[model samples]
Target: MTEISDWRKRIERYRFQGSECVKCGARYYPSRIKCIKCGSEEMRDVELPRRGRVVSYTVIYNPPKKFSKYAPYAVALIELVDGTRVLGQLTDVDFDKIRVGMEVEATFRKLYEYGEDGHIVYGTKFRPVVS
Candidate 1:
């Protein structure tokens, strides 16, 4: 009954991190085995920072049938300090105050839940850095 996504382990580790393809420099959030750009099978694992800024975002009024309960949430493409842009949910603040360039930090949070498997999926999300 954890609150983090299992896939988060792919990108959220302090060590054994992800990286862009050296051959093509294609950004892989979870460190792919091959360059998604050039299809090269060589990739270098690199540590990513926990800080970034909002590159773009939107408020989801209509969610999937299963995710309808969590509708009216803000989703954003956060551009990390290393220049890698990743899409994630933005939390912990008023929706109206969210801005295009607002500073944010990585924070894992509850995304959704389902089934009788008694599992609570958690994933890495972002929240406004409180001043």
Candidate 2:
């Protein structure tokens, strides 16, 4: 990804911002220029629900280069309250305890660092919502 778009996506993920079509009330993640459902350009920015449930997940044994250190982690598709599903890394819990329907909440954590003395990137990770 280009540096500019990476910065743009980082902000959206960190803030949980998505798009909601004002005309049809449809919502999207990573946002969109136009509503896919209604073909309307009247879009509004929406902050997504911080909480969601694990609808599905997979254990990744081999991650990419930058993320190899965090391999063998669970990546889950969480269904948010407003009907949008988001994919995020599950953290702060044992892998054995992860399962479908597990309730989780978004938490910001360090994803990676750039070159030495460069910026340290932070993004959303999910953990079991402690009750």
Candidate 3:
């Protein structure tokens, strides 16, 4: 990503900032300017819940060029404690042990490097919650 775009998204990348509609109490990740539920411009920034459960998942054997180095990684549809469903890559656990309803939590990690300067992009990924 370009430096300008990365700067603009730093908060979202690092903090898991989302939006909540003041009118209807709807919430979204990747914050929206307008509420899709109530069409209200009144919104507030909110931090998403870090803990969640795996709803479903898949192992990607062939990924895009940017992510090919991490091929065969597991990506999961996670339902957060607040009932927000998010898709994120699962890490730091045995692939065979992954299953529906497995507890997980968000962990910040490197996404990839881009641009001629090799700017490292960081973001959230999910790992099994330690007992």
Best by TM-score: 3
Model 1 TM-score, all chains together: 0.77
RMSD (CA, Å), each prediction: 3.9, 1.7, 1.3
- Give each model a TM-score: 0.77, 0.89, 0.92
**How accurate locally is residue 18 in candidate 2, as Cα lDDT from 0 to 100?**
87
lDDT (Cα, tens digit) per residue for candidate 1, span 20-116: 6878776767667787679888778776677899999999998987579888899999998878877888988789999999999988676677666
N/CA/C clash count, model 1: 4
Which regions of candidate 3 are displaced past 4 Å? Answer: none
- Clash totals for all candidate models: 4, 0, 0
Give the candidates in order of lDDT, highest first.
3, 2, 1
The stretch of ten residues in a row with the least summed lDDT in candidate 1 is: 7-16
Residue 56 local lDDT, model 2: 97
How far is 122's C-alpha from truth in model 3 (Å)? 0.5
Q: Summing lDDT over every window of 10 consecutive residues in candidate 3, give the lowest-scoring window.
A: 111-120
**How many residue pairs clash in model 3?**
0
Our tally of clashes for model 2 stands at 0
Q: Which stretches of candidate 2 lie over 4 Å from their true place?
A: 116-118
State in Å the error of residue 83, model 1: 0.3
